[model samples]
Target: MASNPYEVEHGIKPSAPRQTRRPDMSSFHSALHELLPEPSSSSSNRNVGPTPDALRSLFTLVLDQMTALRNQAPAGVDTELLQGLIEELVVDREHPDMKGFLTQDDLDALDRVPKKQLKQGELCPICTEAFLDDPYPLVVVLPCSDERIDPATGLTIHVKHEKHRFDLECVGPWLLSKGSCPMCRQDVNAEKKRKEIGNQERKKANAVDDEDEQDIVDGLYG
Candidate 1:
């Protein structure tokens, strides 16, 4: 039997195919309330909320525990969807103002590869479904890059790119919940924000340089 694509990539075997169910929002909110420390009744502390760092720590703990539980779950039971939902819930509770999903603009900015460009029998890492199976497939490539120092060579080594194509349908929801590539765990949203900041900084620097050059020319001409 052919190895399951997801299992091959992630090492966790699924006993059967299962539909991902929508998470119960009320239950998630209640659970978050329990996990987070309540506001103090004292006048001085009543308005204080959990610090961002504290919330981040709690989120990491919850995700780690949930991932372990999913790995240990009986085969054929699908807990991956639930795990993602819980993660989004935690993010929402911790930082309500923060956007957790890729905006439409972000999605539009992704490189769309033609379906024919995909190798035969290629499957989406998220759903493990063959991309060609769908009559109409919208495929997008993730911009993922990672590097590590080779212990033996003591030199920086760029990791070889793996299968990073996915049906938009399969990956969209996952990115919406996590703002990351499901296969690589690369934080796509965060990277985009960093790039935007870099661009802004460059523009500011160029403007200052242009102003300084103009001032120098005026002084020389006068």
Candidate 2:
């Protein structure tokens, strides 16, 4: 299997054991709300979103907290993953055009799979930790069908199985920065946008066909 580019770039070994001490979810959530306050209902601020500075501050705050948590953990707990993520975010901040981050809506739309459904040995491609390891694992299935069109033959090809699962925490930041499957390097957001456009075009064609049928009926009767 081809190596995930992100892993290769960051020197992340998929076989590394996950850190036993998980970051506090509530603390992170609290930090997020504090950094990016909810928009007011007033007409002046109704549709306004957080400024770039605000977002930068939030990222810094989260990274600092994560680093602190990592420091408190026992030795041999892999911290490379978190450091790799921070480096990637820094690069993304420097070069805005390089970012292919997924939107909140895109992340929200992913299918969540219960931890119990995953096999015992099944590991998240990003963190390489078994899904069952986390007591409250937030596992989500990637939308990649592992299907592609053969440019030479003009035929569709199935590269592999349709479902690719990952730990939400492990994959979320990756998708937010890179917008691709960590396992196959499939462009998730691009595929989603393509499907949406296809659906819209099909709906438009159907509408036109309906109108044409109505016109034909009127012509014959009148």
Candidate 3:
């Protein structure tokens, strides 16, 4: 939301909420609770602690959501950033290094998960339909996987098996965000810089080529 790491790592806040939609889990409620369980709700001063299983579940939940978001991403959104974020999350959860806790790059990398494809007659994550009763229907296969985290390490070390495809039209708009995927909690900005760098490189290359061609033409004509 701060658009980059300088803002995120420095604890810079966004001017306004990014989502005008319901269910913003990016804040303390989901972010903190997912990592650590809330204190005892029943007792005003009682302290409840987070369990290892809760940590596992939270990471697992994030992973599953990411996988779903990635698999269901539309044509417009690419899985590059989300996929990268997943890898980082895996590292953080596994390593448990508070000394270097989440850096800006790490924060920038973290974003939404992909969507899961529909099953035979299973409703789409979006449309809530197969759009028909077609089993083994012709579709785009958005590849996805299941992850397993090490309880001792507090991280996801590996993924297993691939999940199936999805409908493009159904999942596009969410994936079209500038930095992150939909279903993300606290996304980082990505595409803009890469795009700018690409454009600059292309311009330089084209400029050199144009100069060479112009020289050649001048020599030939002269």
Candidate 4:
């Protein structure tokens, strides 16, 4: 009979503790007779806590957010909502009453967010680079007759590419492939109607020409 592998492994060593106990910190204390050391040069300057790299990173984050918001800002976002968001980002997040909390949060939030290409003619706040990327990721704005408007700036947002509207499933790709509007998603129908109307007009013109030719033929014969 062969020894069971599981039992042999377990028998070779005792199982590790599932829950280790924490150390007691009750006796921990600073030396009462010794004078406290002076704060380090780096730690002394509160305003100097942020390194050049950190500052640059922070600036980039602000710029990126601003650019994203601006690109998303279309023709119909509410002023109050924009104002509130701006205030929160600029006043509360950048310069908070609680200190490091806001700065840390801003960096974390911005870093986690995915980068979106701004719309045509839009500028990125971070790099100050004009948005020239094709297929811009534009969110729809509100308060317009159109459901697609910038939520932040209340401006009309145009999605970068006509094909993206179809890609987003807002409209069919075939319709957008021909550069049809994405809003109503009725581009195919419109194209079909246009073709039908054009064919009818052409048929009418041809019929008139045929009748004229028949008249001329009849007159010449008679």
lDDT of each: 0.56, 0.60, 0.40, 0.32
Clash pairs for candidate 1:
none
What lDDT, from 0 to 1, does candidate 3 have? 0.40
Question: How many angstroms is residue 174 displaced in model 1 relative to the true structure, after the best TM-score fit?
Answer: 1.4
In candidate 2, what are the lDDT values of residues 40-71, reduced to their tens digit? 43446433545566566555654554455446
10 residues in a row with least lDDT, candidate 4: 27-36
RMSD of each: 14.9, 14.0, 20.8, 26.8
- Order of candidates by TM-score, top first? 2, 1, 3, 4
What stretches of model 1 exceed 4 Å from their correct place? 1-100, 148-162, 194-222
Reference-based lDDT, residue 88, model 1: 63
Highest TM-score: which candidate? 2
**Backbone clash count, each prediction separately:** 0, 0, 15, 13
Candidate 3: tens digits of C-alpha lDDT, residues 125-172: 333345234333333332223345545545433231222233433332
Per lDDT, the best of the predicted structures is 2
Q: Candidate 2, overall lDDT? A: 0.60
**2 or 4, which is superior by lDDT?**
2
Ranking by lDDT: 2, 1, 3, 4
The residue-by-residue lDDT of candidate 4 on 93-149, one tens digit each, is 344332221112111221111225334555332222233432442222111122245
Worst 10 residues of 3 by lDDT: 172-181
